[model samples]
Target: MYSIHRSFADNCMAVTAPVRSKGRFTIGCDIIEADKLSNRLVALLPKTLDLRAANAVRLGLRELLINAVEHGCLEVGFELKSKIAESDDYLQFLLERQKLPEYRLRTVQVEYEIRPQRIVFRITDGGKGFDHKHRTHKAREDDALAHLAHGRGIKMSLRIFDRVRYNTAGNSVTVLKKLA
Candidate 1:
């Protein structure tokens, strides 16, 4: 396959956010970019008045954002990622994947709307989604601190968001945090 020939930073520069009464942020899978987007989104929510609640939302948002990037856009499998994490090639693998034509252009999108009672976030990725029917909301609380990398974010997200729903395709997830 051919390469896209752009640096991750270059791709991140293309992320576009147009703020208003509602907000949307289109982003690449880079962690720095994801964290930044999470922070920006949380800042827009007045419902997170308590510091602890704000932090929880921030953490969950970041986790799901990374999930969309790695599992969805980058196409890194759970077992394969675990295999790489125990070695030194994981970073190299991600870098290589990010240059490939199929993966390089894929992106994760985060759209948010503030309703009278809650804030909703929809994070969608450009990849073939896995089967998610078997995934449970409480699947990995015990594994949250384990050496495994893939399951904790989703678990944390379930705890933080008031509601979490996944599309049948599994590439898109929607989360809500209540205001009152």
Candidate 2:
């Protein structure tokens, strides 16, 4: 048995409903500006994770959100970010991009679902997306993560979460982690 509840506050509408899965319950959904991700995550994380697992989840979520904002919303590609990684101007570039009306207005939608066994996150960004298929696998080589400026996040998420899936368009990702 499941139920749905909806409410509106501060011009934001939140819907909480259950997924078809037997134990799954939708907690809440939020649409946050790219710039507000850090603050939002900082506030919600403690409630979402046990202290033992908090660090890994925090790292994975941070990486994904950053990718959604910088790469997806702001249209920063791998080559561009990689070049910026080699310079000291990356933060300046990001700040400039964040100030753009087009980028500033873009948002990432996050949906949270809780199950007796696990918690699931569905994060979608208002951007064209990327080629996530190529990055799904764990790197077999020990050195693959050594110098990479990007992509380690997905790999880390794969290790931390029981499952991580990306939509075909790559604009959305669903990650599942078992409850402690």
Candidate 3:
């Protein structure tokens, strides 16, 4: 589903907080920031969860980070995103957006903790938020929108995490997963 999305975050260093503790980091609107951060955070996670579960978390985490960068930081709406996803130069288009003054300085903030019983993540973006309540939650294989590139991230996050809570302003999201 995210085949074209792979190159956006290749071979970049992540800005991260300390390991094995609660930490916070911020990233720019550009694409590399999302993938790098997710890989770094997953490396810092405890090893108790089975490999399958860990992989799920990794995939979901990356998706959420991408969502924040695309929708929140870069202000790319669903309709425009749908159009962009079908194009060959999706990453180039996103990079072009980052060059714009309005989006150049926008950022996404991530706060997280590695706890014994659960993991908590708070992802906040600087752009004006939307009505998150109106966003889709289901990503069924039969769903046409879910088959698209842009809409699956939030659905993946909601499916993999125990809880996903978005702020009233929709700029921030907090996700929790029990470790048992």
The local distance difference test score of model 2 is 0.62
Clashes of each: 0, 0, 0
Index of the highest-lDDT prediction? 3
Residue by residue across 59-112, what tens digits does model 1's lDDT show? 899898887888899988888888897887877878777788888888889988
Per-candidate RMSD, Å: 8.2, 9.3, 5.0
Give a tens-digit lDDT track for model 3, residues 1-180. 465234322211222324347989899996687888887777667755665676687788888888888889889998987787787778899999988999998899999997778889999998788777777434434465645656877778878999999999998999998986
lDDT per residue as tens, model 2, 11-34: 122222232222211111121333
Candidate 3 — number of clashing residue pairs? 0
TM-score of 3: 0.84
Q: Each prediction's TM-score against the native?
A: 0.80, 0.72, 0.84
lDDT of 2 at 78: 78
lDDT of each: 0.75, 0.62, 0.78
Q: Which residue pairs clash in candidate 2?
A: none
Quote the positional error of residue 95 for candidate 2 in Å: 0.8
User: Which parts of model 3 are misplaced by more than 4 Å?
Assistant: 1-20, 137-144
